[model samples]
Target: MLKYGVTHRLSTTYHPQTSGQVEVSNRGLKRILERTVGENRASWSDKLDDALWAFRTAFKTPIGCTPYKLVYGKACHLPIELEHKAYWALKHCNYDLKTAGDHRKVQLNELNELRDQAYENSLIYKEKTKRLHDSKIKNSVFNIGDRVLLFNSRLKIFSGKLKTCWTGPFTIAQVFPYGIVELSSTNGPNFKVNGHRLKQYFGGDIPPMVVPDLQTFPMDQ
Candidate 1:
């Protein structure tokens, strides 16, 4: 895949869940692996097949169906179906070629509609997630001359323990949409940063406001 221009991404870094669908799949896969492995930590590799099978057959809420059913247009007959002789298993065991062909034809005809429904469901889920995420966000607003502190998240591994987390009382040079801000330091170069990582600076000197004295002169005379 890499040779063909397909690149693999590593998670657990900044914003690990880059996409909703991929994050959901990762969570489900982890849950299945945890349950299947139980106490056998070293035998996780051996139980990988069981975890994968469970995940593929399990119903997903966003898609509103199992992955197996979506791809094959039929639910897979598990071992339990054979052991307990379920009605579906029994009926399919003696299933005639003509009936099977008709069933497959119907599935093929409805596949497009099923896929469309799944796509709509995914969009709904994404919108709900976006609303939830946006609800917790408080936008940082700054004007062109406002002084702000920028958070330092790129600390080196061997840096001193007492290093400050914030490093600037940068002047806001420009403001852009989607939390983007251009900053200029007192003695350093100007740079662009995300507004989320900046806070209003209160360390600079301020001039006192002058108030005008009120005069109550005799106006009746």
Candidate 2:
């Protein structure tokens, strides 16, 4: 209901599954009421009425309804004169649920199908990514000071911090296959980096260096 962010299954004593939006909201509302009813804290009920008024007037996105409208079908019609009015709202009208077992049963069935599909999809994506990584590794062989672009992706790195693109035209100072690539920093003379991180760039293949064979003189025995 809190939009499309990926929901998690893990809930611990320390990590309860609640949105920060709700948490901060309650805290702020309480603080506002506490301030307005300072010393006479018991009169917070009066301040809460004003807070509710303020909250209802605020705007929200995606659903495009204020808290007031979400609870009540329409905005509160504030009276300029001393007449008190009651705010009324219509219930959320969507028929997303039915009698007893229907909603739960349908949801359970849908989730089961999603879980199975996710498991199968996971394997497919895993193998595809692995093949890509292996192919790159097999084709790549880095040498010193060879500049190349880094393949940056949080999904690929899994660290969620590595640059997804445009990290280095970093120079390769050393090479260690299947592991690290010692790279030189783009900075001053003090800069250096991992060998495995370095990529080799050929400035248009300058044909492999050829060497001439020299015949050795035979000595008389």
Candidate 3:
């Protein structure tokens, strides 16, 4: 990948949304396998190829075309369609060996253009999705000296159910761009954490509830 000028990005911990596309694809594949395997759950491995073929040939909203079409510069022919004499199949059936070979070569030559178009469509779709997501997200505004509770995300193994996951009422020491916050706690050293982990702490003493004394009077017959 380094030789081909491809850059690798690492997804942050506890944030699967960063790799949303992969997660979505995995979910789709899982659903397909669930439907195909039926009662024989262990035989899902046998249907993996069929599921993959369905996934590849199915139209993707992001790219506005099937993955197979983007790569091959033409739509994939299903077994049923080919058997039932699809237009493309019938056309190719009439063509001689040389003619069919030439047509395939033509499609291969146009594959790059098809891939470029798909890439552009994917970028546009991503931009639209980002805009929609951003519109719904309320931006967090923090300042120095503000009290905030830090979310305890590291405790994943057999944690107590009654214990609160949020750890500290740490004072914000510094607020930086792109949701980076520096926090200082009374019992711990100062540390930088993502702003998303912190929520404003409004700690104060609760007023005690008072109960009035009750007097009972005796009733005469």
Candidate 4:
């Protein structure tokens, strides 16, 4: 339907159920917001925004910079004075910026230097982040004739048809190193499919690999 102007596929489940922790956190956060924000459901949305604000400002591993700082070069100030002081130490003081105003060119130059440095640091930070984050996935690649689970997040039921966000531990007929493999059903004929839509099936209980690294390199002798 590309000619008919279709843009994207709507799904009840798009992202794989790789991490149960994220789902559990969402559930717990719901209970927390509900109990504390009693009878104010509409206002509950603000709690999520606040939670995101807090989370993005918190220290991130590997990169050594928060998502907030990586994005905007600073963190938000909490209402508590000590938290403000802490943030000043973490961000503003590092650059030696006294205030938005009340600054001379020397301080301005220093702040500008820090600001530019932070941006440069962010690139290194982002790469390190990706390296650490992607290290596990890079180890999870499969070869030809491997088994996999294809995701069927296609909203395939109205009432009693079916409801499985995933399908198969199907056999791999062909493997493409770019994280794409040709999948085939075990007990049926309809198996040839794209590998990008599939995941490594680590049985039913264990979660599929989140990020699979398929970068191949020449052997060292």
Of the candidates shown, which would achieve the greatest TM-score relative to the real structure? Answer: 3
TM-score of 2: 0.28
lDDT of 3 at 137: 68
Model 3 poorest 10 in a row by lDDT? 9-18
User: Alpha carbon lDDT of residue 64, candidate 1?
Assistant: 90
Ranking by lDDT: 3, 1, 4, 2
Model 4, 184: alpha-carbon shift in Å?
Answer: 3.5
**After aligning candidate 2 to the native by TM-score, how far in Å is the CA of 75 from where it should be?**
2.2
Q: What does the lDDT read for residue 157 in candidate 2?
A: 34
**In lDDT terms, how accurate is model 1?**
0.80
RMSD of candidate 3 to the true fold?
7.5
lDDT of 4 by residue, 108-209 (tens): 456555556666765675676557756755345667777777766555446355656676678877765434455667577644444456677766576676
Question: Considering only N, C-alpha and C atoms within 3 Å, which residue pairs clash in candidate 4?
Answer: 137-213
Instruction: Tell me which of candidates 2 and 3 scores higher on TM-score.
Output: 3
Candidate 2 local lDDT, 85-204, one digit each (tens): 233322222245564246445545665555455456655655665577557654556666678655442245345455355466667666554345555665745343333343555455
The TM-score, computed over Cα atoms with residue i paired to residue i, of candidate 4 is 0.38
For model 3, what is the alpha-carbon lDDT of residue 129? 79
Return whichever of 1 and 2 wins on lDDT: 1
lDDT of each: 0.80, 0.54, 0.83, 0.59
